[model samples]
Target: MKLLLDFLPLVLFFGAYKMYGIYVGTAVLMAATVAQMAIIYAIDKKLTTMHKATLALILIFGGLTLFLQDERFIKWKPTVLYTAMAVALAVALWVYRKNFLKMMLGSQLALPDPVWNRLTAAWVLYCLFMAAINGYVAAFFSTDAWANFKLWGYVFPLAFIVGQGIYVARHLSDEAPAEKTE
Candidate 1:
């Protein structure tokens, strides 16, 4: 349910884009994101920092796209968001000596410090890679291509998440070790 809610805006934006155009798609994305936020608040009673950040970025970029009559702003939104996240993680891990990912998920996931550090590093790198790829697509390709990429490019995150899950699963202590035969 949460996953569907997360992708609702993007799906709507894709539909609106296919039906109308980029401008209409931007408007639809904004409205759908707002609706999603409202629904999430209604159900969860609180929004995470990620939700607020996504809302802010969408509103800002979508508004700019509409106001300027240019699709470039909206296209750059993902790159900007990914870059910001990478930067935040880098700062947290280096300057502050904090692992933001661990801080956020530590309560639910019990992993060694090394594993947490590795996971955080993986996320930071993944974010940077995502930002770079989005930027490349937005800059070198047509808006139509970029829009299509935006919709279909979800596979990247899905793959990353699966890989991360696999890595974490190996470290989970749910299974008992084999007994020695002696």
Candidate 2:
């Protein structure tokens, strides 16, 4: 359910691009993203920092794409987003000695400090890789090719998430069952 909501804007954008064109697709994406965020807010009662950042970037970049009549802004948005994420995580971890990933997910999962550090490092590297790949495709490829990659590139995140889950599963500490009270 949540996953579907997460992908809704992208799917709509891809479909709109396929049927119409990049400009129309960008409009559809902007509208769909706003709707998606609204639904998320309704369900969660608040938006995370990441969600707000995504919404802001979409509006800013999408608005630029439409206002300037240039597709480059939209094409480079993902690279910007990924690069920012990578930088934020890396700086927080290495410079500040803070594990932002653990701060975000620590309550949900019990893992050792070393495990959290590794997880944060993995996220930093993953974001960098994603940023580079998106930038490469957006810069060198045609609009159609980039659009195709946008739709197909979901594979990378899905695989990365599954692999992260597997790695975390091994380190997860088993909680003891609570005792029954009369």
User: For this target, which candidate reaches the highest TM-score against the unseen true structure?
Assistant: 2
lDDT of 1 by residue, 37-155 (tens): 99999998999898899999999999999999999999999999999999999889989999988788876777788998899889999999999999999999998899899999999
lDDT of 2: 0.94
lDDT of 2 at 117: 94
Best by lDDT: 2
Q: How many backbone clashes does candidate 1 have?
A: 0
- Summarize candidate 2's per-residue lDDT along 1-182 as a digit string, tens digits: 99999999999999999999999999999999999999999998999889999999999999999999999999999999999999999999999999998888887888899999999899989999999999999999999999999999999999999999999999998973233489
Local distance difference test, per candidate? Answer: 0.93, 0.94
Q: Model 2: runs farther than 4 Å from truth? A: 176-182
Q: What is the TM-score of each candidate against the true structure?
A: 0.94, 0.95
Candidate 2 collision pairs: none
